[model samples]
Target: MKIFKYLILLVSLSVVMTGCEKEFLDTEPASSISAEQVAETPAANEALVNGIYANLRTYGVGGTTAHTDYGHRGITAGLDNMSNDVVLNNFNWYIFFYNYTGRVQTSSRASLIWNTYYSVVADANIVINGLGTLENRTAEEDALFGQALALKSFALFNLVRIYSPSYIGNESAPGVPVPDRLTFDGKGRGTVQDVYNQIIPDLEQAVTLLEGFNRSSKQQIDQSVAQGLLAEVYLETGNWAEAASAANAARTGYGLMTGEEYVNDGFDNIGNQEWMWGADIDSESSTVYASFFSHYDSFLGGYAGALDGYKLIDANLYSMIPETDARKDVFVEAGNEFGFPPLSNTKFVDATSSFEGDYLYMRSAEMYLIEAEALVRAGQVDAGIDVLVELVSSRDSGYERPALTGQALLDEIYLQRRIELWGEGFAWFDLKRLSKPLDRTYEGSNHRDFGKFMFPAGSNEFLFQIPEDELNSNDNIGAGDQNPS
Candidate 1:
C-alpha cells in the first residue's frame, strides 16, 4: 500500500509559517514533511485529501492552544460574537470579538483567522499541484483533484473577505495573495477582483469535476456542496442570477427539518437531513473543552453551562421571533425549567452531554435563504419570496406569506436569515456584504456593556487587519498593506 507523509504547513508552503521578520528562512518549519516524501498514487492522494478535511476540525491550527482557537468553529464563534445578534455575558473567551478589538493587527484572533485559512489554502495547493493535470485521470483522481480546488477556493474566499473590503465597490482593493503548491517565493496581495477571479473559476471547475462523485461523509465536498459554495461566491460578487440558480441547484435533494425535528433534536447532529455539510465529531475527534459545544451548548455542562459564559440572542432580534415559531423555543425564556438566564440558548445542547457535539459548517437552509435573497435582489421578488415561504413555513406553522414588496420583503428575508442562521456564523459577514452598520445600542439591547459602541457602514473597525506576523514575514504585505485599525 502506498502512503504519503501527512505534512502540516511548512514555511515553504504557506505565507503564515514562513520564518523570521527580516529575511525568509530556508529552514524547515516545525512539523512538516519534505517535498520528496509527497506521493502521487491514489491511496496517498486520498490521505492528503483526508488531512485537508481534518484541518477543518483540528485544534491548534491557528498556532495557539487557546480554547477559542479550535479550527473553523472557533472562527465562526468569533465572527458571530462580532455581530449584534449574538451576545456574550462574560469577558472570557470571545471578549475581544464582542468589543471589536479582535480584528486589531496585533490580536491573536487576527493572526488565527489569517494563519488557519492560508494553511488550508497551502495544503489544498499541495494536493492540486501533486495531481498535476485533469486529462486522462481516473474518476477517483478527478474527484480528489476537484476537492482540492474547492478547498482552495473556499479558503481563498474566506481570506479575501476577511482581509479585503467588500467585493461590490472594492474590487480594486488589496486582497490576500493567491499562492499555489510550487510557489515557494513570497507573493504580493491580489486585488479583490483578482481573488474572486481565481475563486469563481476554481469552484466552477470543481462543480464540473465533482459531478456524479458520491462522498462517504457530509464533511467531504461533492457536486452540490461545490455548487452551494459557488452560489455564495456569486452572491458576494453581486452576480444575482447565477447565485439564485446555483443555490436552487444546491438544495435539490436536501429537505428542511420539521418543527418537531428542530425542537426535539438539538442542533448538534450532523445526521440531520437538513445538514448538507458538517463535522461528525465523536469521542476521538472531540476537542473536549476546546470544542464548539463547550462554548455554545448551555445545557451540556460546558463553558456556557458551568462557567456563566452563556451566549444569548440580542433582545431586539429575539423580540422579532413569533411566539408560535419553533425556533423561538430554542432560546430559553424567562421562568424556564433550566433556571438559566432568560435567553440563554438551549439550541445547541450536546446529545451525548460529553462535549462531542457535531459542528455544522453548511446546510441546505442556507442555500434556500441565499437563493431567495439573490432572487429578490435580481428582481425575481416573487420567486425569492416563494423560496423564503417554503423554508419559513417549515419552522413556523403559522407563517403567513407576507404581502410585503421591495425593501420590506427583502428585510423580511434578512430577518429570517438572522433568526435561522444566527449562531452558525453569517452575521458579521452578512453585515459587511450588505453595507450595513453594527447597531447593538438600541433601546432594549442585550449586548455586553463594553460592546455597545456602533460603527457606520464600511467602518475600518469591520475589517480584520492583516496580522503583524504576516506583514513582518511576507515581503509582499507591509505596514502600508495593513487595514486601518
Candidate 2:
C-alpha cells in the first residue's frame, strides 16, 4: 500500500496534464499539476491515454533490474523456465525461478510482479475514473476510456492468474485485490470469481467502446485486442461457447505469418503483420544489457550467450518437433556442449548487434489455437480439427489432417501451441489451467535440481505467494492470506 501510494504521487506530479505533446509520456519530470486542472482538450486527453501506453513499456513491468529483464520479459522467462519446454544450462541468475526454490512470500520476483501490475492498474483507474468529470465527450474520449478499462482488466487478469488457483472449480479461492478507484488504502484480495466478474464487465465495456476506433499503434488497445483478452478469460473460466465466439471474432483482420516469416524474422519487430500487440523498443528506450534480446537472443553475447547458452529448449520437446517443420531449426540441433543441454533455443535474436528489439505481447496465431481449443471443448470436434488444419498447415506444409478425435485432437492442439508459442510465454499458464504435472526428473532433463523439478498436478507451487511487503503494510492483507510457500 505504501508503494502504491508513492507511485500515485509520482504519476500525479510528473505527468503534464495541460498542453499535449506528441511524446508527452517520454518527457522528463516537470512542474507538478493537478489532474482536474489539465486534460481539458482532446489532445491533452489523448496524451493522458498515451501515458498508459508509455507505462506499459517502461513502468514496473518493463524496467531493468540487476542481471535480469524483470518486466514482461522477466515474467515470461520465469514462467517458461518453470515449465518443461525451457531448460536452464546453469544455476546462475533466474535459478530460483527455474527451480522454484526462493519463490517465498518475500521473494523479489513475486514483489516485482505484484507491484508492477498494480501500478499499471492504479494509473488505469485514474484515467477511467477521471473521464466522467469532463463535459461534451467525443469518440476520442470514448476510445481513451475503453483503452483504460481494457488495460485495467488485463493487469487484474494477470495478477489473479499468478496469485490464485485455477478458476475451474476453485472460483471461490482467494484472488488478488480488485481496486476500482484511485485510492492508496489496500483493498485486500477478492475471490477468484469476484476478480473474474470484475474483469468480464471491464472487457465487455472495452469491446463496445473500442468499436471502429482505429488505433494508431499496435501498443494501443482496440476492439480486436479486447475480444482476444475476453476470449482468453472465457477459456480460463471454461466458458467454451463464448470462448470460441470471442476467439473467432478476435482474429478478424489478422492472419498467421508464413513459416518462412516466422523463422527468418527476429520475432522482435512490432510491425510484423501477425503481431496483435507489442512494445516497440528502440535504441533510445532500450535497457541495453537487461533487455529482452540480451536475455533470450542466443546469438547475442549477453546473459544467454555469456553462460554458454543457458536458455535451452527441452530435449523431449525438441525431439517431438517434426524434422519437416521449419520451427525444428529454431534451436541448435547439436554441436556446442556448455556442460548442459545441447539443444539451445535460437528462436529470438535482435535485428542488429545492439540489444534493442521489440517485445511481442499477443499474436494472431494464438487466436486460432484458442478458437480451435474452445471449439473442441464445446463438442464441435470436426469444426475444431478444421481450424487446427488452417494453422498447422501454414507452419508445416507436410502436415495433414490426422485421423484423431476427442482428447487426441485436443492433445495435438496443445502440442501445436507449445511449439508455436514456445518462449513467447504460454507454457506455465497452460500447465496450470490444464492441471498438468511438471515431471523434470527425466534422465536428460536440464533442470538444476531434480528434487524441486517434478511438481505434481495441483501442487502449491502453482500459486505465487503474496509479497511480504504487502502483507506487512496492507491492513486488510496479512500472513494468513498468503499462498502456500
Candidate 3:
C-alpha cells in the first residue's frame, strides 16, 4: 500500500490547512494513507484529523452547524431578520420562541454545530487509537495523538453549550450527544450533565497527553488551548473558582496581545501573540470567505454582500453600542441593499483570502473575559470588575463603565458579551442562559408570516422536533420530549 511518512501537522500548517479541501484526504498533508493502513502505522492519522477539521469548517448532512457562530447571533440582536413575514422570519423569534407552533425547521445552526463537533470527536478517537496500534514511536506518532484529544475535547465543549441549556437555567438540563471517547460512535444523546462531565475528563487526559509537546496554532495541541477550553467548560458548569484558575493558567502561558495586536496580528506578522489556538485556514482554499462578514453593508464586502436580504444587524441592539467602542467599528452599513439600513457584521472580516483567513477557536482575550466572569461569579465582584475594565479599556480607550456587582454586574458582563462576541455566535445561548424574556414582532418581509409572532420554546414550543430522519429511522429515540412551559 502506498503511504506517506508525515503523520502530524506543524503549527504553521494550521494556517495552511484549509485551502485545499478536495485534495485533503487523497493527497497527503505531511502524510497520507487509508484507515486500515493507519491502524498499522501513524500515517493515516493526519487524514483522519483533516476530516475532523472539515467537519468544523463546513456544514454537514443536516446543516445544524451554522448556529455556533452566525446563527447564534441571528437568534439574538446581532442580526435582524429580514423576511419577518412571521415571528420566525423576523428575529422576533427571540421574543416568542417558546410559543412557536409551525415546526417546519430547516437547520437550527446549533443542530448542525452539534453534529459537526461530534464528528470532530470521532476523528479524535480514530487518531487516539490508531496511534497506539503503531509499533515504533516517532515524534510524529505522539503529536497526532495529543492533537486529536485536545481538538476532540474542544468540539465537545462547544456542543455542550448549544445542546444543553446554559449553566443558569438547569444545571441538570439534558445536554447533547456524548461521543465515544476511544472509539467513534454517532449514537446517543447524553443529558446536559453527561456531556459536561465527559468534557472535563477528556480535557484532563489531553492536558496530560500533550504535556511537553509544543507546536504553533495549527497542528499541535498546546497547554494553553487545553487550559483555555477547560476554563470555559468549568465556567459552563459553574465551577467559578476552577474556571478562573484555568483561565489564569491559559492566560499566563500564552501572552496577551496589545489592542492593535489582537485585531491585526493573527492574520499577519504578529500572529503568535493573539491566538492560543485556531484553525489555520488560508485564502485560496477557504469556502466560507467569512460569510457572516461578507454581506454588502459591511463596506468591507464579504459574502453577505451577494446573498441579499438576509442577516442584518438588529437595529434595536445596534443602537445600544456606544459610539466610542472600537468594537463598534467592526460592524459596517452596506447601504440598505436589501432595504433596511443594511448593517453588515465585520468583526470576522479578513481581507486575506475571501476575508476568512482562518477560524480562531480560542484566543487570549477570551481567557481575560473568562477570568473576569469566573471571578465575579465566585463572589470576587470588585476584583472581577477590575479585570473587565482593564481588558475593555485596552480594546477601547474611552469606553468606560462603573464597577457593579450582583445582578447588575452580571448584566454588564452580558452587555459586553453581546457587543463583543456578536457575530462570533454566542447570543442565543447567552439569552437562554441568562433567562432573558422572549417575545416577537411580526413585521417580517417574508411571505410566510406577514405579521404574527410565535414562541418555540418552554410553553408554546418546547423540544425542537427531532430531525425528520431520526423520527422516521431511529426507533430507539423518536420525537424528543418537549421542554416544560
Candidate 4:
C-alpha cells in the first residue's frame, strides 16, 4: 500500500526551471526525454540504473527526516537490534527495535521498512518494463537490464522475508504485494510462494544477463553477486545442493583476509580483499550523521561515540569466543577506559573517523560459510568440515578441525557466522530462517533488562506486522488479510 509519493516529487524536481531568462524558462528541459528515447540510449539507461543504486544509500527514503529512517541499512540495523547478539548500552535511536515495539502495526519502523523497499521495487520496475523486448538487446542493454532485475529481486527478497513467515514451510502464507508495473492502484497480499516465484526467476535471469559484464566499482551488482543472492534464496528454501554449488561459484576468486587484516584494518573499506560487494561512500555522497557508522561505530564523532550509543555484543556470545580467536579483538573487555559497556564493538570503526565510512553488504567470507552450511545440511559432512576448517583457521591459528559431525559441525559453522558477521546485519533474519527463538533472558546475559525479551520459535513476534497505513490505504488488504498480532 506504499504510494509513489517520492517518485512524483523526484520527477517534479527534474523538470523545474531554475534560470530567470524567458528563453530558459520556455525551453524544454533535458529531463523531459521520452521513455522511448531513454530506452534506446545506453548511457541514459545506465544513468537510470545509477539512480536506483544511489537511492540505496540516500537518506530520508522512508518519508521522514527521522534519524533511524535511512535506506536499506536502517532496516538492517533495526533487525540486528531485534536479535539476541546485539546489546545497546542506552536507548536513543533504535530503542523501539531493542524493546520489541518496532514490528508492531502502528510503529514507524513498520512503515519505514514497507515504504523504503517497495519504492526500490517500483523504481526498478520502471527500468525493467521500459526496456524493449528480448530479441535484439545490445550487450550494454543486457547488462543494464540484468542490474535492474537483480535490484528488484534483492528488494523483493527482503520484503517477503520481513513481512511474512519463513519460506520453508509457509509457502502459502500471505506476503507483501508484488507490483510489476508503475501504478498507484492497490495490490493484494500474495502467497509467499507467489513472491518467490518472481524472485528466483529474476535472479537466475540476472546471473545470465550479467555473465560477462565486469563492473568498474563494487557498488554495482555483477554476476557473482547475483549468484550469491540466489544461493541465499536456495538456502532458505532448503535446496542444500543448489545453495552449495551457487555459493562456491560466487566465492571462487575472492580470498579470505588474513588475521592481521581482520584485526587491525577497520572494516570500512570496500577495497578489502574479502569484500565482494559494498557501498563506496565518499564525501560528496555522504549522509553525514544519518549513516550506518554514526549509530554503530564507537570511534566516530557521531551518535555511538559522542552520545553513549555504544553497540555492544551480548556477554554470553562474547564468552563463547576463545582467546586464540582474532575476532575477539574487535570487542572491548570489561573495565575499559571509555566507560562504555563491557563488549562494545570496534569492528565497524572509521580509520579517518569520518562520516564517509563505507557500508559492506556482502563479502567472500559469507559465501564460504554459506557453502559450508549448505554442504553440511545436505549430509556432505566431511566436505563441509573441510570448508569450515579453511575459514576458521584463518581467524584462529591455534584452532584445529573439530572431530564433530552432523549437527555439532553445523552448530560450529553457525557460531562462526555469528562471530564474523555480527553487526553487518544478518542476525534477526538468521534466527528466523533457522526457526530459532529470540532468547535474551539467559543467566549472565548482557541484554538490557527492558529489552530482555523471549519469543519462541514460530512466534508471531518474529514477523513484522503490515503497517496500519497499508491496511487503510490498500483496499485489497483488509482486516482479514493482516498478520495476527
Q: Residue 67 lDDT in model 2? A: 55
On TM-score, the candidate that comes out on top is: 4
* Pairs with backbone N, CA or C atoms under 3 Å apart (clashes), candidate 2: 61-71
TM-scores for every candidate against the unseen true structure: 0.93, 0.93, 0.73, 0.94
The lDDT values for all models are: 0.82, 0.77, 0.52, 0.82
Model 3 scores worst on lDDT over the 10 consecutive residues at: 1-10
After TM-score superposition, what is the CA distance of residue 124 in candidate 4 from its true location, in Å? 0.7
Model 2 accuracy (lDDT, Cα): 0.77
What lDDT score goes with residue 24 in model 3? 44
CA displacement after TM-score superposition, residue 15 of candidate 4 (Å) = 12
lDDT of 2 at 156: 88
Off by over 4 Å in 1: 1-39
Clashing pairs in 1: none
lDDT of 2 by residue, 154-261 (tens): 988888988998899999899889875657567778799999998999899999989999987887889999999999999999999999999999988887878887
Worst lDDT 10-window in candidate 1: 18-27
